[model samples]
Target: MSKPLEITNLYKRFGGLIAVNDVSFKLQPGEVVGLLGPNGSGKTTVLNMISGALPCDGGSVRIGSTDITKMKPHRVAKNGVARTFQLVRPLPTLSVAENVQLSLAFGKKRHWGREARTLAEEKLAFVGLEGRGDERVGNLTYIDQKRMEMARALASEPELLLLDEWLAGLNPSELRIGIDLVKNLQGQGMTVLLVEHIMEAVRALCSRCVVMSAGEKIAEGPSAEVLREPAVIKAYLGDDHA
Candidate 1:
């Protein structure tokens, strides 16, 4: 099978700031890959390029067999890519079910009516938000709100899911739950590209991880081994981690 995503010579710049610099990688079908970096290492910029939230200044963003480098963000979603952002901005006025319904309406139409309802319900359940779909999403707890965002993404019936800090602001237990949710999604054959600062969560979920610094990849390989590489340690972890 072909890879779920391939990014080659990717670059993005914000005026004088070089956010993502010539980054490149491939994510295989059914794989969970981690993108690790500090605050300005351009991890999210890479996501923006790959997800079409921001256009890349150079290189290509290919999902499966199609090159979607210059496609609009909405078109990118229609092309089998869905993403959850770090902020988890739920529609304050919309019920959880309605939020997910909007995602379904915008998807590739793999299901509808009862079938769509069933799929949406299943997604909420997968994120551990079962039976709460009727509630206004703004009323949920912070973690639950993030789960709502996740449920919305899953409702897209996506082949690839881009997760930005999927476990960032949670408590220890919430982090565990989030990790389990991601693992369950992976088990269902959804390819995942996770961008996160949580080392433990990344190590736990990612089969392979790519680390970056100053907008370029510094090290990449098996999660545990890569995080421990001397160069990776020095570049990312610095003296304390060493």
Candidate 2:
């Protein structure tokens, strides 16, 4: 079942720099929401906190009714939250399938042996990587590596998927494929929170948007309207655009 994500008063600091400040938003079950911001806007920091890769200085993160504010990364994954990092990280020593198996072993639903292998391959195929499960992670192309990372995330069968710029750096054709892949996930009722700079993809995929600038939320609403807001425009294209 898809789960809702609620973040309230989320904050983070690095010494004197406040990376995030009292940010809050809610994602209803199966809704795809865009997190937009320019470089250093703390969008990635927010994802890190939500995935337990970074500790929150102050705030609350919840999946459905369970609090996950302080959970470890693995524990957060076990609670139906799965994410793809901005930088793809695959186990270099392992085969593509094995990398995905790690997620299956530790994800919300635990699988083992042939079951895990079978499920992992199924996910790979779902991401358009059929029959290449035995290949080394290093052997795949950049886009293929991204596909593998996504397959690994999906192996967890997560209720909420966090995608951090997964659509960036794709060629036009590849971008279309990426967009379709996200659409497929949305169609399958997976709630998604994506941080993307590609305005086209953001406009195509998200029903709603929450935009941040300088660690503070500047706009939130329907994707089209939010993208047109003065504050959001200023954050992305500077004062001239606004």
Candidate 3:
């Protein structure tokens, strides 16, 4: 079942540099929300904290009614939270199916052997990677690798999915395909928190947006309206543009 994600007072620091400061946001069940900001705006850092890839200096992350602030990455995955990295991460040595099978084995349902492979294939098909399961990850094109990563994330059967620039580096036609893939997830009632710089994809996929700048939230509202905020404009294009 789909679940809501609540991030409260999330704080992160790297020595003297504060990467995130008291950031808070919520993803209601089945809602697609965009987390928008410029580079180094702590958008990815927030995702890391929520996914347990990084430890929070202060704050809490909760999915549904369960607190996951201190959980490790695998624990977080088991709790129905899965994410794709800003950089595509795949085990090049493994076949596409094996990669997703590994994720399925570690997922909430913990399917193994043939069961895992079957479910992995299903996810692969869901991400438009059908019948490419036996192909080596290293041989797949860049966009295909991205699709495989999404398939691997889906193998976990997550309630909440976090995508970090999953649409980056795609051509116009590929971008449309990528946007449609995310739309398919939304149609399936999956809660999504997307960190993207692609305004077109954001406008097409997100109903609402939360804008962050220099580790702080500067704006939040309907996607169209929030993008019109001067603070958001400044955050993206600087003072002169605003």
Q: All candidates' TM-scores?
A: 0.94, 0.98, 0.98
Tens digits of per-residue lDDT, candidate 1, 147-226, equal 98999998887888999997889999999888998989888888999998888898788999998899999888999998
Clashing pairs in 1: none
Q: How far in Å is the alpha carbon of 70 misplaced in model 3?
A: 0.4
Collision count for each candidate, in order: 0, 0, 0
Per residue, candidate 2 scores C-alpha lDDT tens digits across 20-138 of: 99999999999999999999999999999999999999999999999999999999999999999889999999999999999999998899999999999999999999999999999
* Cα lDDT listed for each candidate: 0.87, 0.94, 0.93
Model 3 deviation from the true structure expressed as Cα RMSD, one decimal place: 0.8
Q: Each candidate's root-mean-square deviation in Å? A: 1.8, 0.8, 0.8
State in Å the error of residue 240, model 1: 6.8
Candidate 3 shows a clash count of: 0
2-88: candidate 3 lDDT, tens digit per residue: 988999999999999999999988889999999999999999999999999999999999998999999999999999999998899
What value does the lDDT take at residue 158 in candidate 1?
A: 81
Query: 167 in model 3: Cα distance from truth in Å?
Result: 0.4
Off by over 4 Å in 1: 1-3, 110-118, 239-242
